[model samples]
Target: MSADTVAAPRLSLNVRYNRNVQENSGEEEESQVEILEDEEHHADLRPQRARPHTQNNPAANNRRCFKATAVALGGFYLLMLAGLFIRFTLLQTRYDQLSNNNSQLQDEVKKLKDRTEVFKSCPHGWTGFGHSWYFKSEEKKNWYDSRADCQQRGADLVVINNKEEQEFVSELSKDGESWIGLWYEWTQGGWKWEWVDGSLLTEKFWAAGLPHYNGYYAACCIQQGKWTQGYYSDNKNWICEKMII
Candidate 1:
């Protein structure tokens, strides 16, 4: 094509009609040919350039809608997972608390059962406290003889366990000396004392400066509601005690 034809102006139909009216009739045939070629070229390019965007619009819209639906479904699944995890955690924590409460209740029931067994073991004329029995003796004897008398009756010399036991014995004595189960052991130390049950004496209510040992053979006795050390051969009214099965 010539350069002038390549750069030819693209005019509307109305502009071409006006140009034809103003120009000489001698150039009419040539002008008509150029306008006809320009129109044909424009018609070809209009279909080529515009057909792709128009045909693809529906497909582009469908792709955008599909992406939106996928995003919404993914968010819903994430929310469901989070809710399930939270519920599982709450249930596990509740189960642990219930387990702890059940264990505590079982312990309480066991204690009650043990206490009932101890109460059932008490015989006539014997007082019950904890898991043992107590008896007040009316006769007098030395510490060793007192223990022997208790043994004859299937019992032993009394062991004072706490303030309540000491008070019970003091009340029964009514301000007099009584042989009890505490004695020194040359098996360990000159000063070591323990109950007959082999348990060490950890607490005692003793008279002031009064556990004065008469050599390595001292025994304990209850006097005026307090513990006092005495010779093993000393004579006093005694108390007997026994343990439940």
Candidate 2:
């Protein structure tokens, strides 16, 4: 009876020890599965490392775009200012050329006028009538003295060639009486009027019914568009005439 009882207790103890070892093994397996789950969750929650902060951030992208746009606009502004400066330089050069051309044209026109204008061709103090030049002397002188004065001046008394020339003298003699190149001389046909240059008096402008040969010699003097006979020694204003040289 004592050997059987001892063997039976030892068997019970072995069974209990084996049961406890199996429970501990199960608990360790469960803990290992929990640890694996926690590791997977941590891996999913961690931030990615491939992309940097600048690509995902909105403020950073906007600042980069603003910098690019500012650079582009500033370049355009500088280009426009350079183009304006170039255009202004070209316009200024063109204006200077035009001014030079205008000045040269003005000088040429003045030279042309000086060469072509007949009125300006006459000497000072002389008046041009048609193609002839005339000068009036304010000092009174006799006919012979007037003729000598005209000869000394390289001219002669005004010779009225036509109605136009007669009018010219009439207007010129408006202020006072003046001697013309005409005189009466004793001829074979009695007395006749003649010019100082030995030209015939075919065209005459004698005032109404007057050639009154009261004296032996006669000369012509003009006064206010009228002609009167006077002595060769009569003192009167004189007119001198010559062709334009």
Candidate 3:
């Protein structure tokens, strides 16, 4: 009541202390805006570092394309086992050249079948059928009875003319049979062949129908058919003549 009421109480206590300081600054700016919105919501919940794993990824390029297709299938199975070892060494060198050409064609077919069986048992220049000369026989003979008593010794009984004179009369009849010249006479009527220098019957190596005179008998001469086809009474196997020196 005396100096203005003591300065109105000290300005009303300084206006209530500036209104409490502006209401504590406004509650500290609203707690700093809720702490900046919780630090932007924890920076959007974390975790991001995983992107560094690359290798151009599509599952790491499909595991490097399956290890380059298993090394190109092991180099194509080692080139098919070296082409089956060069086709089994060219089939064992063509089976040893066809077994040496079949053993040289079986030794040339066994020497051409032994020269065709020695030209079918002797045969070359044989003659008879006429009259050369005398060839008679009455034996005390024994050289195969003087060669079958010379077939009664006559005109055309021994004539195997070739294979080198039938191996030279089978080596001179080996141990027996001899007298050889040839005879047979009775002329013109039919049986005629004499050759021992007297020459007559022109040259007839008969085999077919031979000196036929069946009944009249004088069939003197001509023998050797145990393998060529000729016969008179069958037994005499002679005839290996050769004269032209």
Maximum-lDDT candidate: 2
Candidate 1 vs candidate 3: which has greater lDDT?
1
TM-scores, all candidates, are 0.62, 0.48, 0.23
Model 3 lDDT on a 0 to 1 scale: 0.45
- Looking at candidate 3, the ten consecutive residues that score lowest on lDDT are 128-137
Write the number of the candidate with greater TM-score, choosing between 1 and 3: 1
Off by over 4 Å in 1: 1-121, 215-224
Query: What's the TM for model 3?
Result: 0.23
**All candidates in order of TM-score, best leading:** 1, 2, 3
lDDT of 2: 0.76
lDDT of 3 by residue, 2-93 (tens): 88687987868556445645678775666566667777766654433334443367876788888788778777777777777777778777
Point out the higher-scoring one by lDDT: 1 or 2: 2
Candidate 3 stretches with Cα past 4 Å from truth are: 1-67, 70-74, 106-245
Report clash pairs, candidate 1: none
Candidate 2, residues 106-131, lDDT tens digits: the string is 99888666545866767777898766
**Largest TM-score belongs to which candidate?**
1
lDDT of 1 by residue, 1-245 (tens): 68756556644535666577678665666777778999999999999999986686887789999999999999999999999999999999999999999999999888778878777766777777756777777777888899998898899988778887778777766656777888876556555677887888777878778665433222333555777667777778777888763
Candidate 3 at residue 111, lDDT? 50
